[model samples]
Target: MIRTGDEYRESLNDGRQIWINGERVDDPCNHPQFKPVIDIRARIYDMQHDPETQGAMTYEEQGERFAIGLRLPYEQQDWQDKRDAVDLVMNDIGGVVTRVGDETIGEMWSLWDGKDILNEIDPRFATNIERHIHQCIKDDPFHVSANTDPKGDRSKAPQDQDPDMLVHVVRETDAGIVIRGAKYETAAAYSNQAFLKPTIANWGNDKLSDYALGCIVHMNAPGVKHICRTGFAGRAPEADYPLSNRVDEIDTLMILDDVLVPWEDVLFYQHTRAASFIRTTLHRYSAFPFVQRTLSYADLIIGAALWNVKQTGLDKQQAVQEKLSELAIWREGINAFLTASVATAEKSPNGLLMPNQSLLMSSRVHALTNLPHMMHLARELCGGQICVTPDAATFAAPDTKPWMDKFYSINEEWVADDRRKLLGLARDLLNSDYAGHRLTFQLFAQSPPFAQLAAVYRNFDWQGPLEFSHKAAGLSDNVWGKGTRH
Candidate 1:
C-alpha cells in the first residue's frame, strides 16, 4: 500500500480544524504558510514511488512488498536503506529541518503504535496496530510526535507545572478518556493528521500520573486547537527572499481542552513506567537514523559553502581552504559513524532491522557536538556577504544595477547578479529566521545536548573496551563482567 506523492497531498484535504494564530484555518491545503511544508512532505512521499529511490524506500518480505522508512526493524540492510531514503528526501527539500517536518514523525508514530501492539498487555492491541499501520500506508498521513511537556520549571515534574502545561487525562469512561492541557513546541502540527504520545518519560510521577497518558487524535477533533509561530514562509515574496519562500514548516503549540480519545487509539494510559520505557526505546531506535539525516544535510551545506567560496574568489586563500577542509573533515566524521552504524545493524526480536546501539549512540553524541560547529564554520567561510547581500529586487533595480554590478563582480568570472543570488542563498542558510529555527531544532530535537551526551555515556559499552584493553595487557581473562554495566 505504498502511497504516491499525489495521494499524500490529497489526504491533507480532509476537513481538519487546524488554527494558525487565533483564526481557525478553513483549509490548510490552501494556507500560505503551511503549503510549502506540505509540498516538501509530498516530495518525500514521491520519493517512495520514484524509480531511483523506490529501492531504498521499499523492501521485500515474504514475497510481499512494503514501503520501508526509519521505523523498520534492524535488518542488516535496513540501516543503509533508511539512510539513503532520508538523503533522498532531505536533498529534495533543500535542508534538514524539513526532514523533521511530517514524514519522519508519521513513520515514527506508526512504528511505536505497531510495537505497542506486539508488546501489549491485551491481545486487542495487535488489532489496533494493524489497523493503524494500514491507515498510515494507505493515507500516508502527516503526524507530529507530541512528546515534550511544557515544564514550568526545569527541576520539577509535570504536576509542578501549571496543570494546563502538560496534557493529562481528566476523565475516564468505558468508551475512552478525556484530556486537557497542551504540548509545547510541536513541529508541523498544522499539517499533521494526529499527534502521537504527548508525554515522554521525564515527566512521569505519581502526582503527574494522568499526564503519562498516550493516545492519537485527529487535528479537527473537538477541543483541539493549534497555535503557530510567525513563520518565514509567510514573511515575504520568493523573488525578494528565496530561502524562506519555499521551505517554512511552521512549528506550533497545541492545546487540548477536554479532548476525548477512543479506547482504540490509546496506546498506554496511567502506565507511568511505560513512558520511560518508550523514551529509552525510541531514543535507541531513532539516534542513527537522525544522524543519517543530519549528515546528509551537512553534506549539502558543505557543497554550497564550498561553491560560495569559489564564487567569492576566496577558495584560493589558505585560511578559506583550511576552513573548507575542516568542513570536509566534519562531513567525513559524520558519514563514517553513519556507515559504521549501518554495517553493524542487527535484527531486533520483533524482526525489525535497526542500527547498532553503540554506533547509534556515538552518532547522536557526535551530532550534538559537531552540528553547530559545522554550521558556524559554514557561516565563517561564506563571510559577511551572506548577511549584506542585496535582495533580488535591489539587484533588478535599474538605478542600483550599474553600481551593484561593479562592486559585486569578482575576477570577471561570475556575473554580479549570480554572485548576489549565491550570497542571498548563503544568507538564507546562515542569517535568516530559517537558520535560527534550524539551530533551535538541532539543539532541542532529542533533549538538551548534555542529556544526549549522558545517554550516550549510559548506553556506551565502556566496560567492553576496558576489558579488551585489560586482556591485551594480560591483566585479566574475564570479559563477561562488562555485560553488567547497564
Candidate 2:
C-alpha cells in the first residue's frame, strides 16, 4: 500500500540513533533540525495521494498500483511519468534546496542495486533488490546514498587512507558481514529509513577484499552514529525567518562502528567490477534526473529573487533587470537540456529505459557550473537591501515601528512593516546562514566539479561527434583529441 503523509511520519519513529552537535536526539521526527525535512518528505508522500498529482505519482502494474518512484519500471512512459512527478514535487517546494535523500538519491540507489540483478549476481541480491523496489513503491523510504569516504588525502586509495576514514568489511560470517568507518557530508541522515550502499566505486585489486562491498542497513542498526552539521535553518526563530527555516534541516554525517549487515541486505561483495559498473550506471542515470529537477529549482530561485527585487523597488533598475534576465536564461538552459535528454532517452541492456547518458552528463556539467552563478546573480540583484532589512522582531517591536516606517519603506504602496517583511525574506535568502547553506549544497552536490566534467568526457562517445566533424570536412581518416573542455 502507498504510504500517506501521516503514515510516512509515523514510520520515522523507528528510533534511529542520531546526534546533533554533542547529544543524541530522542525523536528526529519532532526535532526542529530534522522536522522540516520530515515535513517536506511527508508532503511528497501526500502528493502520491493528492488528486491532481495522483495521475503523475501513481501508476498501475500487474493489477496493483505503484508510486512513480523507484518502483516505476524503467520504460519510456514510466520515465516520463517519473519526470513529471519529480517536477510536481519540486514545484510545490518553491525550489529551496531540500535534502536529496527522500526521493532522488534513495530511488537512484535502489535502481543502481537493481542493475546488479541484470548481471546475474547471487539470487539473494536480486531478491533483496526486488523487495526493496516494492518497499519504495509502498512507502518511498527516505534514504542517504554514501559513496564518498573521508579520504584524508587526495592522492590515495581506500586502503591507503586511514581505515577509519573508509567504510570496510571488518569480518565475514555465515549470517552477514560487519563494517566500520564513516561517510561524510551525508544529507538527511536523521530522517532516513536506511543508508544504502556505501561507496559504489570499484576497489582496486589490492583493496577489493576490504573496500569492494555494497549493502543496505537500517538507520538505527546497532553501532550506527549520526553527526549533523550546524546550519542556518535550525538555529533561527521561525517567526523571524519563515521560508529558510523550513528548508535544509537535516544535513549530517554518518558514522558506522562495527555495523552488521545481514546476508539479504548485501547487494555485492568481493565483486569490484560489478561495484564499478553499478556506480557508473547510478551516477550516469540518477545524476541527470537531479539536473533536470534543478531546472524547476532554478525557476523557483529566479522567481524568489525577482520577487525580492520587485519588493525592494529595484525591478525598474536596468542593472537589476539584466541580472534577472541572466537568471531566466540559466533556468531556460537547464529546462532545454532536461527536455532534450527526455526526448532522446534510450533503453538499457536490461530493458529499463534511462536518459541519454551523454546529454544528461552535459546537463549535470552545466548545472554544477551554473548553480553558484544563479546564487551570485540573486545576491547582486538584492544589493544593499539584503543587509539593511530589519528582522521580523524589529518590525514587531513597539518602539521601532514608527522610526522604521518613515525611512525603511521601499515603496509608497507598501507600508514600512510590510516592506520589512519582504526584506526579511530577502535577507533570509541573501544574508542569512540559509544563503551559506545554499552555497554549501551546490558545492557539495557537485563537489570536485572538475572530476564530474572529466567523467562526462570519459563516458561520452567522443567518436560520434569527432566522426561527424571529420565527415563534414570530407576526411577519410578519423582523428580524436584528448582532454575535457569547459
Candidate 3:
C-alpha cells in the first residue's frame, strides 16, 4: 500500500535511539538537522499517491498498489518503470537525494538474484530473501544499506583486532542471534530498516565464521544505537546552501551493541561462500539507481554552470561556450551509459532483468572516477563569485544592503537577489563543506575506487579483446588454445 507523508513521518517516532552532535534526537522529523531530509523522503512517499506522480511512482496489481521502485524487475519495462519513478521523485524534489529508498532497495534484489547460492547454504535463507523483497513492496518502508564496517586494523583479522570493529554474531538464542559491532550507514537513523551484510570479501576459506552473515536490521530494535555524523542541514540558511539544508542524506555510524536478529530476518549466516558471493554481486542491480543519481546530479551541475554564464553574458564568449559544452558532454556521457545499459539489459540467473552488467559496471566507474574533475569543471565555470559571495544575512543587513545590491546586481536581467541565490546554490553544490562530503560519498559510498574497477574487471568480457588482438597480430592457434569468444 502507498503511504502518505504523515504516515512516513509518524513511522520515525518509534523511539529509535538516534544521536547527533552529542544530543539524542527526540523527534527526527522535526529536528533541524534531520527535518529537511526526512521531509524530502516523506514527500517522495507522498508522491506515490499524488495524482500527477502516482502513475510514475507506483503500480497497481489486483487493486493493491506497490512502490515501483521496490518491484522485482522481471522485464525491460519493469526496469524502465523503476527508472522513470526515480526521475519523477528527483524532479519533484528539485534536487538529487540518494538513499531515500529506491537506490538501496535494489541491494536486496541483488541478493534475491543469488537465491540459488543462498539455497546451497540454507533453503530457509533463500526464502527469507524472497519474503523480505516482497515485504518491502507491501510495506513501502524506507530502507537503506549497511556495508562499511570500521575495521580497526585492515592488516589484522577481525578476530585479531577489536572484535567489535566488524559486525558479528556473538551468540544464538531461541529468539534470535545477538550481534555486536557497528556500521557506517547513510540515512540509517531516519530510515525504517537496513540490509546489513559483511564488508569483507576474503573469508579465509573458513566454512563458518561469525563475520559471514547477512540480515535485516530494524533501526529501532533493542541495542541498535545510531550515532550520526553532524548533518549539514540547518547549519546554514536554506537560502544560501539550498541543497545542503534541504536534501542532505545524513550518514550514521550505527552501533549494533549485541543486537538481536530474529531467525525470520536472517538471510544468511556462518557461510563464507554465501558472504563471498554476496560481496561480488551486491551492487549488480543497485548500481543502476546509484549511478542514475549521478546523472541527475550532473544536470544540477550543468544547469548551475550554464545559468551562471548566462547571467554574466559569458555565454556569447567562445571559450565560455566551450566549457559549457564540456559540462554537457560529461552530462550526456552519463546519460548515454544509463540509457544504453537498460537498452542492452541482461537477465539474471534468477530470471530477473538486470541492466547490462558490463555497461553498467563501466558506467559506474566512468561516473565516479571523473566526478571530482566534473565538479571542478563546473566550479571553474561558476567562477570566483560562488566562494566570495556574502550570506543572505549580510546581503539583507541595513548597513550593507545598498552596497551588496550595487555589487551583486549584474544587469536588468539579473537582479541582486537572483544573483545571490544562484551563487548560493553554486557554492553549496561545488564549494561548501557539504559539497566535499558529497564528492567523498560518491567515490566511496558504494565501495572504494579500486573495488568499482574490480567489478568492471569481473563483468567485462576480456575474451573479445584478447581474441581480436590475437587474430590481428597473427598469433598461432596453439599459443592460446580457446574456443570462440562467448
Candidate 4:
C-alpha cells in the first residue's frame, strides 16, 4: 500500500477549500507558500520507492509492501525501524519536518490502546478505532491530529457562550453525524485526514454531551475549510533563510462548518469518559516522534554554532568551549532520554509497544521547557555577526564582492562564501522570525508545559520516594496514604 510521490501529490487536488493570506489556493502543490514543504513531503514519499532508500523506508509484510512509518508496533524492532526511516528522511531532505505522517499516525494507536474504555460506551466504537488503525497501513494515507478548539471564552462554558466554540455533534443522520466548530491543526490543509478529538478534559458531570466526540475527518470533506497562517517559505531569499524556505510546516485554523462524518468514521461520541481517557493519553505514542524532531533541531543549532565558532577560531578558547559543552550536555540529555525510553519500551493495553512513559514524558518537558534558553546559548556562541551579515545578493554584487571576500575570508579552508553561508544558517536557526515560530511550536505543539508535567505526574512512581522517606523517618506505612499509584 505504499504510494509513489506523484500519487501523493495528485491526491491533494481533491477539491478541498484552502485559503492563505486572504487568497484561495488553487493548487497547494504549486502554490509558493506550500510548494516547498509539499515538495518535501513528496520527496519523503519518493524515498520509499527510490532504489537507494526503499529498503529503509518500506517493509514487506505477507509479500505486500507497506510504509514502515505506518506499521503498528508489536515489537521493539518496529520502533527502531520507524526511527531509522525518520532519520533517513531528515538526512535526505537536509532539515527536520514533523507531521509528515509517522508522527500523527500514532495518535490513532493511542486511541486503540483505550479500546476497553471505548467498549464501555459502545462495542461498535472500539471496533471502529481498530479498523481505522489498520486502514492507515492498508491505504498509506497522510494523517494529522486535530484536538485544540477555538474555545472563545475560558470563563464561560461552551454551551453558555457559543456551542460552536468546541467541536461537537450538531445532529445525527442515517449516514453520519454532522459537526460544527474549528480546530487548530498544523499541516491540515494538505494532509489526507486528521484524528479529530476534544482538547479540554473537564466536561462537567454530564455522562453524555455533544462536545464529547471523536472521529476521522477527511481534509477535503464538504464544509471543511483550511485557513492557514502566512507561510515563511516565500517571505525571504533561501540563501538567508534556508530552513524557513524548505521546512516550514504551515499551520491552519481548520473550520469544520457542519461537516458530516460517516458512521464508520466515528471513534467515540456522547461519552465524556471516552473524551477524558483520550485527552489524558492522546500523545502516548506520538510523543516519541515529536520529541525526536526536537533532537534533530538541537543538532541544527549545535552544528551552526560550532561551525561559526570554528570559522572564527574561537573554538580554541577554553571559555568558548565551555558554552559549547552546555549545548552538548542539553542535546545529549534529550538523546539519552529518547534512547532509554525505546530500550525500556512497555507494551500497551492493546499490546502495542510504547516508549517508557515516565522517561518519554520527562524528556518531552526537558526538550520543550528549556528550548528557548538553549537557542539563546547557541545565539550567544555564534556572536554578533549573525545579525549584521550581508545578503547573498549583496555579497555577489560587483560593488561589494572584493570587500566581502577580504573581510569574510578567514583562511584558505574557510572561504568567504562558506562563512557567509554558515552565518546565514545560524541567523535562520536562532535570530529570524521563522526561528521564533519554531520555538513556539516546540513549546506548545503537543500540549502546554503544564500538561506535559501532568503527564509526568500521572506516570511517575511517586510511592518509591514516599516509602523511602517513611522508612528514613521511622514513620508507619499508614502515614503515606493508601492506594498510592500502583
Superposition error at 245 for model 2 (Å)? 1.2
TM-score of each prediction: 0.87, 0.88, 0.97, 0.98
Tens-place lDDT digits, model 1, residues 1-486: 666667766766666556776677776666887777777776776777788877776766567555666344545665556666777666667665444433344334434544654456455544565566556554445555664666566566666667767778889999888998877554545454454564543453353377666567777677867777766886865765566877766766777889888988876666555555555555666666666666766876787798888876789999998988888888888788778876876555455665666777778777657877888899988788788777777778899988888888876678888788777777777778887777777778766777677767766777767767676777634544554444
Instruction: Tell me the lDDT of model 4 at 117.
Output: 91
Preferred candidate (TM-score higher): 2 or 3: 3
Question: Where does the lowest 10-residue lDDT sum fall in candidate 4?
Answer: 477-486
lDDT of 3 by residue, 61-127 (tens): 9999888888888888998998898888888888988898888888888888888888888899999
Q: List the residue pairs that clash in candidate 4.
A: none
lDDT of 4: 0.91
Query: Which is better, 1 or 3, measured by lDDT?
Result: 3
lDDT of 4 by residue, 176-217 (tens): 999999999999999999999897844679898889999999
Candidate that would win on lDDT: 4
Task: Report how far off residue 261 is in candidate 3 (Å).
Answer: 0.6
Alpha carbon RMSD to native, model 2: 3.4
List clash counts for every candidate, in order. 7, 0, 0, 0
Arrange candidates by TM-score, descending.
4, 3, 2, 1
Q: What pairs collide in candidate 2?
A: none
Preferred candidate (lDDT higher): 2 or 3: 3
